[model samples]
Target chain A: MRRLHHWPLDPASRAARFALAEKGLDVDLEEARPWLRAEPLFRLNPAGGLPVLEDNGATIAEIGPVLEYLEDAYPGQPLMPRGAVERAEVRRLIGWFDVKYNGEVNAYLLHEKLEKRAQSLGAPDPQAIRDGRDHLRWHLDYLAGLLDERDGLAGPRFTLADIIGAAHLSCADYLGDLPFDEFPAVKTWYSRIKCRPAFRGLLADRLPGLPPAKHYDDLDF
Target chain B: MRRLHHWPLDPASRAARFALAEKGLDVDLEEARPWLRAEPLFRLNPAGGLPVLEDNGATIAEIGPVLEYLEDAYPGQPLMPRGAVERAEVRRLIGWFDVKYNGEVNAYLLHEKLEKRAQSLGAPDPQAIRDGRDHLRWHLDYLAGLLDERDGLAGPRFTLADIIGAAHLSCADYLGDLPFDEFPAVKTWYSRIKCRPAFRGLLADRLPGLPPAKHYDDLDF
Candidate 1:
C-alpha cells in the first residue's frame, strides 16, 4: 500500500502528486497541513514537512527525496533524463523552482494570501505582495525565454522540471497572480502540460471559503 | 580540465569541494562572489548561483545537481547509499540542512555576520542573531539525538549528509557561532569528519579582512 501525505495547494506536495500520477502509480492521498505541525505528521517526518510518501513500511519525506524515491523504486516511467548533463539540467531547474522561485515569490505571496488565513496572521502586507509580484514577473520572463527554444523547461521531453514549474505556477494561478498573457511562450507551454492527465488532481482543488481565480481550472484561459 | 567556480565560505560551495575531493576528481577552484552577480557567472548559470562546476565542456550549477552529477559521472567513493530507502534518508538530511537549517539559522546568522560585511549593510541585528542561535541549538539537539543511534547521519556510512552538515556547521563555527561544547555528540561527530583530507581545503579558507574563530580550523578543539 502506497500513501502520500500532502496539502492540496502546497507546491512541493503538488509536485509529488504530479510525479506519482505521471508514473501510473496508485497512491492514497492524505491531506497534511504543514503550518499546523501535527503530531502524526511529525511522527512520519521528524522535520514536519509536507508531501511525505509512505510505501508499505518505508517512509519518504520532503519533495526532493520523495521524487528521487519514486524514480529509483518505481522507474517504470522516467521523470529524469539518462545523460549526466541532461540530468544535471533537470536538477538545476528543480533547484530553481524549489529554492529561488519559492524564496523570491511564494515566501511572500503564499504566506500572505494563503498561510496568513490558516494561521489567522492578520491582513496581507501590500508592499510584500507588490515585491512578490515584481519578482514573479522576472521569473516568468526567464521561463518564457526558456520555453521559446525548448519543448519543455529542461529539454525536449516533459520531465520533473515541468512538473515542478507547473506545481508552483498552478499555485500562483490559483491566487490569480500569474500574468499568463504577458508571457505567451510560458502560457503555451503550460497549456500543453496542463492538458496532461496528471494535472487533473490539481485543477479540482478548492480551498473551501478561499476560492481560486475564475480561470483557475479553465484549460482555454 | 575540470574547474569549480565557488565562494569559499558558502556551505553549498564547500559541499561541492568536499564531494569532488572525495570522488578523487581534481578540480581547479575558482572563487565567484554571488553578491556581485558577475556577468561571467550569469553566462554559465542563468540563475546566478555560486558553486557552478564546469567539467570540460559541460557546465553544472548549484549544489543539488552538482552533487548528483558527481555521483553519476564518478561512482567511486559513493556519497549516497545504494538502497532506495537509504538514499532517500540521505536526501532528507540534505534538504534538512539546505532548506530548513539554511532558513532558520544561516538566513539570520550568516546574513548579519557575513553578507552584511560583503554588501556593506549596517550593523547586525541582535534579535535576529539571537533567534538564529536559538534555532541552531534546537537543530544541534536534533543532530545529537540522531548521532546517539547511528554512526553517521544517514546510517553507519559517511554520506553527503555528513558533508552538508559539516559545511553549514563549519560556516557557523567560522562566524564564532555553533556551541559545540553544549552538544558533545555533534562535536565528536564533527571531529571525525573534520580530520578527513576532503575537509582540509575548507579549513584553509580565509577572507582578506575577516579571520575565522580561534579554533575554527583546529582538529581537536
Candidate 2:
C-alpha cells in the first residue's frame, strides 16, 4: 500500500487520488497542510507542493510524475494508451491542464478565495482573477472542440488527460468558479467523469473552512 | 518533416527547437510575429502563443505536446527515458519548468523586460517582478540541490528535463537575468549544456528589439 500526502480540496491532489483509484491501488490518504510548511512533508518535498506520495520510502512530489509512476509501475487497467503518438497526445493534454489550466484558473481561485493567508503573499489582484476567468473560458472552449472530435481529450479511451481536466474543474466547481452553463459539452463530460467509481473519493471530499458549492457532490446535478 | 512557427527569441520556441534537434528531426522553422496577430498562424492558434508545430496537416500548439510528439514520432536518442518511473520524473521536471518556472521567472522577465506589453494588460507591477526574482533564486538553489545528487535532473541520462531547464535558463542568460554567481552548481551544469550541439540554434537566436547580453553567444563565457 502507498501513502499519499494530499489535500482533498486541491485539484492536483485529487487528480493523483483519481489516478490511484483508476489503477485500483489502495493508498493511505493523509491530508496535508502545505502552507504550514509541515516538517516531514517539507523534507520530502523541498518545494512544499502537494500530492506527495510515499511508496515504500521514496517520495514522489509532482502530480505528473505520480500519475506516470502509477501508470507505469502498476499497469492494470491501462490508463494511458500503448502507442507512442497516442501516449504523447495524452501527456500533452495532461501538461495542458497541469500547467496552462493551473496558471489560468486554479492558482488564481485557490489562492484568492480559499487560502486565508494569501493576503500576506499579496492581496488577490482583481485583474488576475478576471484574466483567469477569461483564460478558463477559452480553455473550456478548446476542450469542447477537442471533445467534439474525439470521445476523450486524447482519443477514444479515457486517459490521464480526462483525470487532470476533471480535477482542475472540480476544484473550480468547489469554489463555484466554474461556469458550466457556458460550456455544455464540458459540463456533460464532467457529468460522465463524476459518475466514475474512481471519482467517488473526490466527490466525497470536504475541505475545512471551505465548503463546496451546492452541486459539488450531487451526481445528478 | 515538420514545420515550426516560432520566434527566435522565445524560450518556449527554443525548447521546441532543442527537442527536435535532440530527436534529429528536421523542422522547417518559420519565424512568426505572434504579436501582430498574423494570418493563418493566429487563426490556427487563437491564443497567439509561440512554437506551434505543423506536422502531417495537424497543427500542434503548446511546448509540452510538441516535445512529446517529437519524441513519440522520432525516437532517436530517446529524449525521455525508457521506464515509466523515469519518464514520469522527466515529465514532472518539464512541468516544473513550463509552469512553476514560467510563473516565477519567464512570465516576469520575458513578458515585462522583453515584451514590455505586459503593462498594457495590467500596469507593470513592480512587486510581481520582485517576487519572480526571489522565486527564481530559490528555484535555482533547488535545481543545484537536484544536480548535486545526479548527473541530470532525473538520473544519469540526459532527458527532456535538462533540455527544458536549459531552454528557460538560456533565455534568462541571454537577457543577463540569471545571477549565475549565486548558484555555482547550476552555473556549471548550464556550462555543460551550453556545449551541446543542439544548443547552437538557441545560442544563435536574435530578437528584433531585445538584444542579447555581451556574453550570450560566447560559449566560453
Candidate 3:
C-alpha cells in the first residue's frame, strides 16, 4: 500500500496528490502540518517537510523526489514529455514555479496571508501583501507569454509542468489573490486544467476557519 | 560544441559545472553574473539565472534542468544510480540543499557576504551571519549523522547527491564559513569528494577581489 502524508493546501503536497491521481495510484492520505514538525514526519523525512511518500517499505520525501519517483516507478501514465529537450523545458517550468515563483510570490503572499493566520503569528503585513501582488502580476504575465506559445505550459500535451503550475495557482486562487481576468490566456489554460479529474481532490480542499474564494470551485469563472 | 554560461561562486552553477565535468563532457565556459541580467543571458533563459547550458541548438536553463538534461541525454558515465529508490534519495538530497539548506544557510550567509559584496550592496549584517552560522551547525550535525551510516551520501556509490552537496558546502568553505573540525565525518566525506577530478575546476575558481579560505583547495584539510 502507498501512503502519502501531505497538507491539503500546500502547493507541493497538492502537486504530489495530483500526480498520484493522474498515475491512477491508490494512496492512503495522511494530513501533516509542517509547522508542528511532528515526530512521525521527522522520522520518515529527517528534513521535516511535507508530501512524504511511503511505498513498498521505501519512503520518498519532498515534492521533487515524490513526483520523479512516480515517473520512474510508474511509467504507464508518463506525465513527462518524450524528447530530452522537451523534458528539459518541462523541468525548467517546474523549477520556475517551485523556486522562482515560491520565492517571489508565495513566500510573501502565502506566508503572510495563509501561514501567518494558520500559525496564529499575528496580523499580515500590508506592504508584504502589496509586494506579493506586484510580483504575482509579473508572474502572470510570464505565464501568459508561455501560454501564448502552446496549449500547455511546456507544450501541446498536458504534463507535470501544468500540474505543478496549476497546483500553485489554485492555492493563490483559493485565497482570492489571483487576478484571473487580467491575463485571459493564463485564465483559459487554468480553467482547462481545473476541470481535470486529477485536480478534483485539490479543488475540494477547504482550509478550516478560513474559507476559499467564492468562485474558486466554479468551472466557468 | 557544448557551452555553459555560469557564475563561478554560484552553488547551482557549480553543480552544473561539476556534473558536466564528471560526465567527461568538455564545454566552453562563459561567466554570466546573475545580478547583471544581461540581454544575452535573458535571451537564452527568460529566468535570467546563472548556469545556463547551450548544446547542439538547444539551451537548457537553471541548475535543475541542466543536470537532468545531462542525465537524460548522456547516460554513459551515469551520475545517477540505477534503482528508483536510490534515485529518489539523490533527488531528495538535491531538494534538501536546493531548498532547505539554501533557505536556511545560504540565503542569509551567502546573500549577506558574497552577493552583497559582489553587488556592492553594503556591509553584511552581523545578526544574519550569526543566524546562518547557527543553522550551518545544525546542518553539519545532520550530514555527520548520515555519513556515520553510509559510505557516501544516498549509498556506497558517489552519486549526484554528493556532487550537489559538495557544491553548496564548498561555496561556504570558499567564504571560510564552514567549521570542518566540529564535524569530522562530514569533513572526511568532503575531503573524499574534494579529491575528485571534477572538483578541480571548482577549486580553481576565484572572485576578482575576494579570495577563498586558505585551506579551500587543500585536499588534506
Candidate 4:
C-alpha cells in the first residue's frame, strides 16, 4: 500500500490527499508535524517539509510531483488532460495557486493566526492581514473569471489544478479568512467541490487550539 | 514567431528563455520592467510578473508551464525525460528551486538588495541577510548531495530542472550572494552550466545600480 506523510491542515498535504482520493487510490496516511523537524521525515526531505509520498518503493516529495506521479501511475479518472497544451494550462494554474497564493495569502494567514511564533515577533498586524485580504480578493476574482468560461480553472473538466486550488482555499476557509460571498462564482464552485466524497475527510479536520470557522463544514455555505 | 515578455535579470524569465534556447525555438524577446507594472504587461499577466510567453496565438505565463509547453510543443531536444517517473522527479526538483529556493532565499535577497522600498523599510537588516546566507548554504549542501548521487539533478541527461536551477543560482551569483566554494560539487555543476551556449545571453544580464559580480562572466572563478 502507498504511504503518504502529510499534515491534515497543510494545503499541500491536503492537495496530495485530494488527488489520491480523486483517483480512488487508497493510501496509508501518516500525519507528520513538519515544523517539528521529525527525524525520519527530516532525513527523507532535507528541506524538512510535509506532503511526502512513499509509493511503489519511490519516495516522492513536493506536491507537483506527487500529483503528476498519481496521474501517470493511475490514469483512470484522468486528473490531467491528454493534450500537452491543455496539460500545460492545468499545470500553470496549479503553479500560480501553489506558489503565488501560498506566498501572498495562505502563508500570511497561517503565520499570523495559526503559528504563535510569528505573533511573538509582533501582534497580527492588521495591515499585513489587510494586504493579504485584498490580494486574495483579486485571486478569487481571477478564479471566478476562469470559472465563468470553463467548468474548472484549466479547462472543461476537473483536474489537479482544481483540487490544489480548492485545497488552499479550504485551508483559508478553515481560518474564516475566505470571503466566499464576494465571489459568487467561486462560492458556487466551492459548493460543488465540498459535495465531493474526497472533501468529506477534509471537513472533519480539526486543529487543537484553532477551531474552524462556522461555515467551514456547511455544504450549502 | 514566439514572443517573450521578460526582464533579463529575472531568474524565472531566464529559465523560460533557457528552455526556449535549449529547444532551438526562436523568440522575440521584449524587455519588461516588472516593478513599473506597465499596462501591456499587466494585460498579459494581471499579477504583473515577469516571464510571460506568447506563442502561436496562445499566451502562457509562469516558468513551469512555459517549460512544459515548450517541451510538449517542441520535442526535439527533449528538455524533459521520456519516462513518467523520471519526469516526476524533474518537475519536483524544479519546484524545489523555483518555489522553495525562491521563497526562502531569492525573495529575501531581492527584497533587501534589489527592491529599494523593502531596503528603505529598515536598514537592510543585517540579520535577515545573514539568515539568507545561512539558508542558502544549506540549499547548496542539499544540491551537492543530489549531484553526488546523479550526473544531473533529475537524471542522467540534463533536463528542465538543471536549466531552472542554474537560472536561480546565476541570479544569486550575479549579486555575489552564492558561496560556491562551500559546496565543490555544486560549484562544478554550475561551472558546467556556465559553459552552455544557451547560458550566454544570461551571462550578459546587467541590472541598474546593481552591478554584476566581478566573476559573473568568467567560466572559472
Candidate 5:
C-alpha cells in the first residue's frame, strides 16, 4: 500500500486524493504541515510541500509529478486523453487552474480564509479578500466561457483538467468565495463534477471553524 | 515552422526555447508582452501569459504544456527519460524550479532586476533583492546536493530537468545574483549545461540596456 502525506483543505492534496480515489488505488493518509518543516515531511519531500506520495521506496512530491505519476504508473482509468494534442489541452487547463487560478484567486482567498487560521495568523486582510474575490470573477467567467466550446472545461469528456479545476475552486467555494449565480455554465459543469463519487471525499473535508458554503456539499443547487 | 510568443528574459519562456533547441525543433520566435496583455497575445492565450506555442492550428500556452507536447509529439529528440519513476523525477525537478525556486527566488530577483525595468516600474525593492539572495542560497545548496547523487540534476542522463534548471538560474546569473563559488557541484553541473550548443542562443540573449554579468556568457565561468 502507498502512503500519502497531505493536508485536507489543500487543493493540491485534494486533487491528489481525488485522483488516487478515481484510480481505485488504496493508500493510507497522513497529515503533514509543510510550514512546520517537520523532520520527516522535510526528508520525504525536500521541496517541503503537500500531496507527497510514498509508494514502496519512491517518494513523489508536488502535484504535477504526483498527477503524472498516477496517470503513467496506473493506466487503469486514463485521466489524460489519448491524442497528444488533446492531452496538451488537458495539461494546459491544469496549468491554468493550478498556476493561474491558484495565483490569482486561492493564493489570496485560501491563504486568508484557511492557511492563516492554521498558522495562528490573525484576521484576513480586507484588501486581499477583495482581490481574491475580484480575480475569481475573471476565472469563473473564463471557465464558463470554456464550457461553451466543450462539455467539460478542457474537452468533450471529463479529464484531469476538470478534476484540478474543481479541486482549486472547491477551496474558494468552501470559503463561500465563489458566486455561482454569476457563472451559470461553470455552476452547471461544477455540479456535474461535484456529484462524482470520487469528489465525495473532498466535499466531506472541512476545517474545524470554517464552515463550508450551504450548497458546497449539496448534490443539486 | 512552429511559432513561439515569448518574453526573452522570462524563465518559463527560456525553458520553452531551450526545450525546443534541445529537441532540434525550429520555431520562429515572436516576442510578446504578457504584462501588457496586448490584443494578439491575449487572443493567443486568454490567460495573458508568455511562452505560448502555435504549431499548425493548435496553440499551446504555458511552458508546462509546451514542453510535454514537444516530448510527446516529437519523439526524435527525447528530453524525458524512459522509465515512469525517472520521468516523475524530471517533472518533479521542473516543478521545483518552476514553482518553488521561481516563487522564492526568481519571482523576486527577476521581477525586480528585469521585468520592473521593462514595465518602467521604478527601482527594484532592496528588501526583495535581499530576500531573493537569501532564498537562492538554499536553492544552490539543494542543487549542489542533487548533483551529489547523480551526474546531472535529475539523474545520470541530462533531461528537461536540466533545461528548466539552467533556464531558470541563467536569469539570476545574468543579474549577477548567484554565488557560483559556494556550490562547486552545482557550478560544475551548470558549466556542462551552459557549454551545450543548445544553450548558445540563451547565452547570446542580451537585453538592450542591461548588459549581462561579467562572466554571464562565458563557458568556463
Candidate 6:
C-alpha cells in the first residue's frame, strides 16, 4: 500500500493528491505541516515538507518528484502527454504556476491570510494583499487568454499543468481572492477542471475560523 | 543544434548548463539578464528568465523542464540513474538546492553581493547578508553530513542533485560566503565535482567590476 503525507490547502500537497487521484491510485493519508517541522516528516524528507509519498519501500519527497514518480511508476493512466517537447511545455506551465504564480499570488494571500493566522505570526499586511490581488487579475487574464486557444493550459488535452494551475488558484479561491468574473475563459476552464473527481477532495478542505468563499465548492461556480 | 540562453551567475542557469554539459550536448550560447526584463526573453519564456533552451523547433524554458528535456530527448549519456525511486531522490535533491538552499543562502548573497551591484538596486541589507552567511554555515555542515554518508548528494552515482548543489554552492563560493574548513566532507565533494570538464566553462565566467572569490576556480581548493 502507498501512503502520502500531506497538509490540506498546501498547493504542493493538492497537486500530488490530484496526480494520485488522476492515476486512480489508492494512498493512505497522513497530515503533515512544514511549519511545524515535525521530526518524522524530516526523517522521511530532509527538506522537511509535506506531500512525501512512501511506496514500495521508497520514499518520494518534494512535489516535482512526487508527480514524476506517479507518472513513471504508474504508467497506466498518463497525466503527461506522449512527446518530449509536449512534456516540456507541460512541465514549464507547472513551473509557471508552482513558482511564478505562487510568488505573485499565493505567497502573499496564503502566507498572510491563512498561514500567519495558523502559526500566530501576525495579521495580513494590507500592502502585500493589495499587491497579490493586483497580480491575480493579471494572472487570471493570462489564464483566460490561454484557455481561449487551447482546451487545456499546455495543449488540447488535460495534463499536470492544469492540475497545478487549479491547485494554486483553488487556494486563492478559498480565500475569496480570485476574480473569475473578469476572465470568463479561465472561469469556464476552471469550472470544467473543478468538476473532476480528482479535485473534489481539495475543494472540500476547510481551515479553522476561516470559511471558504461563497462560490467555493459550488460545481457551477 | 541546441541553443541555450543563460546568465553566468544565475544558479538555475548554472544548473541547466551543468545538466547540458553532463549530457555532453553541444549548445550555442546567448547571455540573458532577467532583471533587465528583456522583451525577447519574455517571448521565449513567459516566466521571463534565463536558461531557456531552443532545440529542433522546441523552446524548453525553465530549469526543471530544460533538464528533463535533455534527459528525455538526448538519453545519450544519462545524468539521471535508472529506476523510479532513485530518480525521486535525485529530483528531491534538486528541489533541496533550487528552493531550500537557494532561499537560505544564495538568494541573499547573489542578490546582495552581485545582482544589486549589477542592477544598481541600492546596497545589500546587512541583516540579509548576516542571515545568509549564518545559514551558509548550517547548510555547508548539513552538506558535509550528507557527503559523509553518501558518495554524492543523492547516492553512489552523480546526478542532477550534485549538479544543483555544486551549482548553488559555486555561487556562494563566488561570494566567499562558504566556510569550507568547517565542513571537510562537503569541501571534498566540491573539489571532486568542481574538477569535472563539464564545470570548466562556468568556472571561467567573470562579471565586469566583480571578481569571483579567490578560490572560486581552484581545482583543489
Model 1, range A1-221, lDDT digits (tens) per residue? 99999988899999999999999998999988878888999999998988899997999998888888888998888988899899999989988988899999999899889999889999999999999999999999999888888999999898989999999999999999999999999999989888999899899999999999999999988
Error of 1 at A218 (Å): 2.9
Fold similarity of candidate 3's chain A to the true chain A, as a TM-score? 0.97
Off by over 4 Å in 3: none
lDDT of 1: 0.92
lDDT of 2 by residue, A41-111 (tens): 87877667888988866678888788888887888898899776678678767777776677677777777
Which regions in candidate 4 have their CA more than 4 angstroms from the true location?
A: A117-135, A208-215, B108-131, B206-211
- DockQ scores for all predicted structures: 0.81, 0.43, 0.81, 0.60, 0.79, 0.82
Would you estimate the TM-scores of all the predictions? 0.94, 0.85, 0.94, 0.88, 0.94, 0.94
lDDT over C-alpha atoms for residue B90 of model 2: 82
For candidate 5, state the interface root-mean-square deviation in angstroms to 1 decimal. 1.0
Candidate 6 lDDT by residue in tens digits, A125-186: 99999999999998988888788889999999998889888888898999999888888888
All candidates' chain B TM-scores are: 0.97, 0.89, 0.96, 0.93, 0.97, 0.96
Candidate 6 residue lDDT tens string, B1-221: 68999998998899899888988888898888899998999999988886899999889998878888888998887778888888888888877876788788878888888889889999899999998999889888888788888989888888878888898888888888888888888888999998899999889988888898999999978
lDDT of 4 at A63: 85
Sorted by lDDT, highest first, which candidate order results?
1, 3, 5, 6, 4, 2
Residue clash pairs of candidate 2: none
- Tell me how far the alpha carbon of residue A169 in candidate 3 is from the true structure, in angstroms, after superposition: 1.1
Q: Who is ahead in lDDT, 2 or 3? A: 3
Clashing pairs in 4: none
Question: Lowest summed lDDT over 10 consecutive residues: which window, candidate 1 chain A?
Answer: A29-38
Cα deviation at A66, candidate 1, in Å, is 1.2
Cα lDDT of model 5 by residue, B1-221, tens digit = 69999888999999999999999888899988888868988888877787899998899987888889989989887888987788889988887887789889988899898889999999999999999999999899988888999987889998989999999999999999989999999899989999899999999998999999999999988
Cα lDDT tens digits, model 4, A59-135, are 88888888988888888998898777788888887888777888888767776776544235667767777888887
The per-model lDDT (C-alpha) reads: 0.92, 0.81, 0.91, 0.85, 0.88, 0.87
Error of 4 at B145 (Å): 1.5
- Candidate 3 Cα lDDT to native: 0.91
Instruction: Please give, for residues B1-221, the per-residue lDDT of candidate 4 as tens digits.
Output: 68999877778899998888888788999988788767988888766787899998888888888888888788899888877689888988888887789888887776677664423565576677888888888789889988999878888889999999999989889889988988899999999989999888889887766789999989978
